[model samples]
Target: MKDFSTEITYKTSRSSGAGGQNVNKVETAVTAIWNVMESAMFTFDEKLRISEKLKNRINSEGLLQMTSSESRTQLANKKIVTEKMLELVEQALFIPKKRFKTKPSRGQVQKRLDNKKKLSDKKENRKFKF
Candidate 1:
């Protein structure tokens, strides 16, 4: 993976709620945009993987866009967005380890059979004798 830090672009808008007059005057909400298709951070295959995994978050323009208004400061909001982007990209790139099938051991199988036998006996005892 290449350095994605250089590729991110940020936009700001007025934050909503709880900041009183300060919210009206400042553009503190930060929106981070990174174009997956145009990114040099990954190969074509990796880009495709990212696009597929993040299809819902990505727009029609091929940009994976995220916003942060959690912090009152623009820099803090910007930091949050960058962290979100990093986490999302890492998740998209992750490959799950393949699973291998295994059979139960003899002791495990015997335990299951013994439990079933006990349950059967319990039910048999519950039925009225005829």
Candidate 2:
């Protein structure tokens, strides 16, 4: 993959939570935006995978936007958003290993049947006889 950071764009606004006067005065919150479809880092298939995995995060215009306001400084929030976006893209590209189904052993299956039978007999014994 090429430099994903190169294609990223950022927007800033006043953060809502905490930071007291800093929050109200400065635009500390950072919003990272990247065009997933237009990104040259990944192929079409990989872009498709990313879009599918991050459907909720991607806007109608096809821009993947993420916001971070954890820190009081704009730089910290910007760094956080970049890292967050990279991590998400990395996760989306990963392909999980296929699981092979296994059947229960014969002994285990027989034991299960025996346990059922024992329970049935115990229940049968609880009934009053004529």
Among the numbered candidates, top TM-score falls to: 1
Candidate 1: residue pairs that collide = none
What is the per-residue lDDT of model 2 for residues 1-130, given as tens digits with 9 covering 90 to 100?
3459989999999999989877779999999999999988898999999999999999999999999999989999999999988998999889999999999999999999999999999999999999
Query: Which 10-residue span in candidate 1 carries the lowest summed lDDT?
Result: 1-10
Under the 3 Å rule for N, CA and C atoms, how many clashes does model 1 have? 0
Error of 2 at 17 (Å): 1.8
lDDT values of the candidates? 0.91, 0.93
Q: Output the worst ten-in-a-row residue range by lDDT, candidate 2.
A: 1-10
Residue-level lDDT of model 1, residues 16-101, one tens digit each, is 97688999899999999998989876999999999999999999999899999998899999998998899889989999999999
TM-score of 2: 0.87
Model 1 C-alpha RMSD vs. true structure (Å) is 1.7
Using all chains and alpha carbons, the TM-scores for the candidates as numbered come to 0.90, 0.87
